[model samples]
Target: MKKKIWVNIAFQVGALVLALLSTTLLLLAAGAPPFQAYAAILKGAFGSAGSLETLLITWSPLLLTTAGVLITFSAGLWNIGVEGQMAMGAIFTTWMLRLLQETSLPPALTIVLGILAGIVGGALWAGLAGALKTFGGVNEIFGGLGLNFVSTALTIYLVFGPWKRPGVGSMSGTEPFDRSLWLPTLPDTELSLWSLTLSLLALVIIIVLLRGTHFGLRLKAVGKNPKSAFLMGVPTWQYSMLAFLLCGALVGLAGAIQVTGVYHRLLPNISSGYGFLGLLVSMLVNYQAVWVAPVAFFFAAVNVGSIQLQLMYKLDSSFSGVMQSLLVLLVLLGEGARQRFLRKH
Candidate 1:
């Protein structure tokens, strides 16, 4: 077991090195100094207190989304509709805030209610996909993809129609929520400590649930071999749906945070591809609960850091996407090679 752990660590490090080298070559080919670009990246992500705060803000949603993805992956379920779920969450959060903007309720309580609504919204969307897979005999991947399109269309319609900024029906999204609806940020920074704390709390709960609970063990059994697990009396379907529920809720929380704590409004592409990025993080960490946060933070840093590359070297921010894709590819290849080597030995 220790040998396997060491091997995994070594492979992860090797993958990072290879990814950096590849990114460096790409930078050189683009006629930019690789080292200087890298330096700028670090500077953008961590040079100032404000930049560090931005890094933490980015890390918050990533931690939530990746942790949620880990849950579904552990259940052998591919929840490809996380993007839709997140969108739904944002929509619901915005709706709640808009509806109660003039209410007499305390702002804190109103915010809590809005967050809950977001979670419900996300769960409903995820549940629809899960139902299609479990009962309608549709593959989750296809069902999820379809739902994602529907969600996107729905959001666009709302933004352009009823929720459109007064008489200016642009895709910019609904008018910003009342300032009272906004989540409290850290002093002198746009970073919300509430969101960060919530993310950390969620991580702890997820780790504990997945590693130390009977339900978790059952889910693992179902994932490993559903037929065998069923023979052993595990209700595979129920557990799978439960995973979807919990995962959706977590992702929804992230969306709610993004709305209230970050963007402060519903917008087109509010998810910002974080759902898909979370999928990659889950894959890179092999869906291990313990590794999810660190990997997520690293990816978030890469994202936040890429801005400097864009500004300093006139490089496209998509370069970060390229780096991320390369890293995932290399990590997957390394995992396969390790498995092959172990089998041979």
Candidate 2:
């Protein structure tokens, strides 16, 4: 176990170094000093209180949504549909807001409704994959991938049709949510305290559930050896569905938090592809909950800091995403190599 962990760590470090090198190459292409660009990237990520705030703002959603992915991954399910689930979550919450637009309820209560609505939306989207895998005899990867397009189309439809803001472009969305329904902000910080707390609580709950429960053990078994588990009388399909539902709910929570805490309004492109970026984080950390925190924060830093890199060294801001993707690919390749080397010995 120790050896395996060390291997994972080594691969993680190697991938990070390669990511940095890739960024440096981009800097050189732009006729800038690579070292200076690197330093500036670091400085922008953590150089001041303002930078820290920006990092946290980005970190909030990444952390929550990645943790959601970690849940299904633990059960050996690839829920690539988190993007759609998140979109549905936003759709549900926004619709809830619109429905109650005329209600004179307290902002707190309406906020709760929006959050719950998001949870339901996400769970429903994720549930479709579970259903397909269980009854339709479909592979989850393709099912989830297909669902993402559907959800994106649904989001666009809502914005352009029923949810269109009055007198605005037909391709746009509804009026901004009520100010009272906004998520409370952390004192002296752009971060949302409620959202952060919910994510932290989710991390703790998932850790305990996965590490200390019979259900977790069975879930692990289903992932490691599905046939064997089924022969042993474990209801693999049921457990898999359970996993999908949990993943959906968590992803939905992420969407709800995004709208309430950060956006305060819906957009067709509201997601920023954070759900996709989260997949890279999960793989990089080897699905370890503790490691997800830092890995996500670092990714968020790079994402936010890349703006400075663009300005200082003429680097394209897209460099950060390319770096993240490369890191995930390298880690997987390195792991495969290590396993092959062991088999040879």
Q: C-alpha displacement of 148 in model 2, angstroms?
A: 0.9
Worst 10 residues of 1 by lDDT: 169-178
lDDT per residue as tens, model 2, 1-345: 898788767866786687677766866887888887767878989999988888888887788778888878888998888898898888888888777768897788888999899999999999998899999988889999999999888888877777777765454455677677789887777678888888778877777777789988898888888899999999988989999998899888888887888887777876678888888899888788778888899999989877897887667889788777877887788778777886585
lDDT of 1: 0.89
> Which candidate leads the pack in TM-score?
1
After aligning candidate 1 to the native by TM-score, how far in Å is the CA of 148 from where it should be? 1.0
Clashes of each: 0, 0
Q: Give RMSD to native, each candidate.
A: 1.4, 2.1
